[model samples]
Target: MVKTPLFKSLPSRDRTAAKKLVAPAVIGIWIVILFPLLYALYVSFHDWILSQGKIGEVNFSNYITVLKDPLLLNAAKNTILLTVSVVVLEIAIGFGLALLLNNKRIRLRNLYLFILLVPMLMPPITVGLIWRLLLHPDLGIINYMLSLVGLPQPIWLADPVLAMITIIIVDVWHETSFIILVLLAGLTSLPDEMYEAAMIDGASAWQKFKFVTLPLMAPTILVATIIRMIAALKTYDLVYILTRGGPGISTETISYYIYKVFFVFLDMGKSSAMAFILLAIIILMTLILMRVMRTAEQ
Candidate 1:
């Protein structure tokens, strides 16, 4: 056989070192993340109950019951609606804000950006509490302002439609900063030469944005959308603090429903089954988003 180059042996050594460096992280992940997921999966199939204090027979009854539950169905529908609406609105508002901040004529752009990011920095529970006070029908500043403007003050959290709208609004306020930050970074990184080329071709503002800005920003947009979508799907803290899935479950997302089942009903098996279903849905959404991102890249 021909003598192998010393570089080939060096490559093998580097590979071994790389594996050694990565092995601890991989094992840690298995212990911290994968192990819990596997345990949850195992428990999901069994008739486990808090009160029973024992794992019963393993079967699909938990999943079957969850699927047939009308409340769960409603919760799933609400979650989908909330996720879509919040993501769309967040993208729109965030992009607009990013564009405004990117304007060369704007003064104090950094200050404005900082102010907008403050809401996102706040804990969800704190944001919810603040909004709850503002949304209070009786003494809320929001209603007071509406009254000043001679507008009728609707029950923000008590009305089903309004409750959902309120939740969406709160979510948008808290999360749009994330989208704004991502889009602004994408905008800032875009090569100025592309805009100059478009200008040389006599492209209008709308044309440049439609053809150049959007295509380049597509990946960033997809990332922000997917993150916000997943967060919206698993929304609980704000909902719990603000409405507690009240107004007859109008604002109850699947996560909140699962919490109620797990803690309130103490149905560990059904809750785990629901949790797994939610996980599957989130994974499916993530895959779909990745596919879309790939298409956009192409």
Candidate 2:
């Protein structure tokens, strides 16, 4: 057997050309990512109100105030709940469906996948708007159908708990498609030789899944989860269009709350501070996912 080196060194001319090709991307990153991040950090430490139309004096206690606010705490709690629920639900459902479709016995797999992916392909804001109208108490098709069936037609986004639950259900429906797509790709790309070996060993279906599939699929699952979790943490458009974090802040997530502070309340400094906090949170979660992926790979 022969093994080949993964990387090949380019000739000097090719190397120079490669550097030139990558320079624009690096510059774009600096302009798009680094500059805004630095500006946000700078703004976070100062007292700036949009109404004032100026970045005011530096207020070192900005973070302290943000941390102390009860509403911030509430929003953080809501965000955590929403993120955890949606991620877990999406991953479980997506993986199950992916496994089902991955089986050779499954017919019309592409059609099923196409239908499932429709929600995800649509704009998130559009999904939210459609769901909002569908769940409307008076005129919604959902409630009208419920009335026809003699079932109770509850206000989907009116009550606190129900509003949160409504948001979660809608989110799961919208985001699960992404997880399925990613995990399905991973499943299809897995080496068939390993499965053949498992079958030769007389491994039971459950055992094959537990020992063979799970271990191999762990990293892919973690990657999908990390992407979804980051997006969930920054969720605002859906919340904005659907509930607007209404029903007495029941569905108010950190991102939506931050948006309100930044735009509605016109508190740029506080909003920037909250945004940084959320960014730190996302980075921490990504690091944790990376660590888990490393362990799984090992």
Count the clashes in each prediction: 0, 0
Question: Mind giving the per-residue lDDT tens digits that candidate 2 earns over 196-274?
Answer: 9999999999999999999889889998999999999998888888889989888899999999999899998999999
lDDT of 1 by residue, 19-123 (tens): 999999999999999999899899899887788888888877888888999999999999999999999999999999998999879999999999999888889
TM-scores for every candidate against the unseen true structure: 0.92, 0.92
lDDT (0 to 1) per candidate: 0.91, 0.92
Q: Model 1: runs farther than 4 Å from truth? A: 1-20
